[model samples]
Target chain A: MFASRPVVHPMEVAAAPANPAQQQQPQGVLMKDLPGMPGTPSGLALRVTQFLLAAVSLAVMSSTSDFASVTAFCYLIAAAILQCVWSLSVAIVDIYALLVKRCLRNRRLVAFFAIGDLIACGVIFSGACAAAGITVLIAQDLLMCSENHCSSFQTAVSMAFMCSFSLAPSFVLNFWSTAFAYRVVAAG
Target chain B: MFASRPVVHPMEVAAAPANPAQQQQPQGVLMKDLPGMPGTPSGLALRVTQFLLAAVSLAVMSSTSDFASVTAFCYLIAAAILQCVWSLSVAIVDIYALLVKRCLRNRRLVAFFAIGDLIACGVIFSGACAAAGITVLIAQDLLMCSENHCSSFQTAVSMAFMCSFSLAPSFVLNFWSTAFAYRVVAAG
Candidate 1:
């Protein structure tokens, strides 16, 4: 298990690569080399799913009458729109990378994806919770919603929740890839 | 910038250590070796702050009359309680590490901390948004809350937000360190 290789200087190990961000082309150094990560087929699929769910949520909320009157619903609408735009943009990137057969393993790009996904995750989660909370209050406690309005509000909230769920895996995968990239920089 | 190191075996590098979990005591490495990471003094301070803020939020929410009647407020209470318990436990661990001058740079432990912090961040954020939304509705849209209840709810939401803010740095630091650890294992 201890096959020796030619000696390399510690300073060499410490030195940064000329283009570190674009340098990782792991031949056989480790496990599958960032498999199923962002910029891959799986990532493209995730992004597409996110975009569709967010769009559906946004459409549902937009169709609801006077949804703008409730602050929570308004926030949900805004978040859904943000999610839709962000996911669609990333999906387009993923498609281009797939068409060109280029790996999206650049540390910088993955870091950007990770941070962006995190922000989206937080914002969407907050929106869904807020909308759901208000819907609950309106339907159960306040008794303020007509049957039709109440159903529309509930549908929009549920759609928002579905959007959040679809975004979760993307968030986790991006985070892991980014974390691994940072680790590679330090260890190398 | 290319320095060489003594020859080491590819197999040995690939081989897992007998106690990999306890073996990371980086010395003479770049970037100060996980400075301000979890289990350090800075980490301890973060945990303490999170605990105090969560506890205060919980206390305020508990003191409010009819808070349980609102699902959103109940969620906030639950999240705050969870935050307090989680943060306090981690703080105790941090204290032990500090007193003994032991670094908590174990990759596994740090990974655990990162995941836990992420969960707590999401939960707290959602709870804060939900509570804030309902509070706004009650006070402004519905005009159902008495002056005293409205003020108390507002205070609790603000504290919960503060708790989330304090947790953010801790989450980021732990994530970075854990990412580095994973990289080391892969790139060795």
Candidate 2:
């Protein structure tokens, strides 16, 4: 009974359209997209921004010793450290590539980059999010004590938000470059 | 002074050795690698596990309404919804690909999957981290209240940790498939 309905391959379905113009689009995109290239100006800029964001996230969250009191806040600090290390390592490589006018051609290195970025991305998100939750409570009148504590909470939340903004671009850039690099390797 | 160093193009570097064996390995990997293919059995299982983890995370955290008072607990519920929605959507598509015995061959769709998975990963991590902070506060005697509250806090922290565990595999699987898909498209 199930065989009554014709099953088709996605490639066949796409090929059936027989539109030459349509077939050309993906290659065009593959050639034009720069987000996946490792040492392009924009890519380097993204790495730099990521490093700065991690620094900002760590710095702002740690502005008050009170953060040591909350486990989530502590988690954020640790995540920031991971993010910073990864970003710095990539940035150094990117600079080397630029100065030497050569690409990072190692497939293993690219794979490692992809894995590390993904993990750091996850770590930073968790840290910022946990801290955000705490800050939200403090913002919404959860803190019944000193105005000093309230101000500190407000400052920390802003830092978390900043961290989130930084992470978004870094994630996009990393995913794009990793895909692009793999595609290049596959095609070669 | 910079001109003292020789500059060479990346393509030229790759072309220089002209190793026939090296040329063949990428395509072999392209054909054999399952990580980059969607709708495979392992891919589907990863999604299902993610959905279940999110469910467990929410259910355990919400065993008592007391969590509602804490903003991080509320955030965890919201993050779980995001995780579930993304997981279910991908699973449905994966099922279709399996039933038809065809790949999800669209480049745009694969890109969308990568972006969505990354975002959800970030969201869930954040929620788990936030709730983690609060639970630690309670466990460390920072709460200064009822013993029942302390017990509930312990339970929720354990659940968040489980959520973290589940998220790791899903992220890895998503990254692998997305990279593979892009490589296929680029090669084509």
Give the per-residue lDDT digits (tens) of candidate 2, residues B1-188: 12332222334544454566645554423333354346777878777887787777677767776777877788888888778787888888889989998766354555577667667866776677777766666666276646546666556556655655665665555555566655565544
Docking class of 2: acceptable
Candidate 2: deviation at residue A91, Å?
A: 3.4
lDDT of 1 by residue, A7-39 (tens): 333345456554453345552222234444666
List pairs with backbone clashes in candidate 1.
Answer: A3-B9, A8-B4, A8-B5, A9-B3, A9-B4, A9-B5, A12-B3
Which one is best on DockQ? 1
Candidate 2: pairs in clash: A36-A176, A36-A177, A130-B130, B36-B177
Q: Could you give the CAPRI-style class of model 1?
A: acceptable
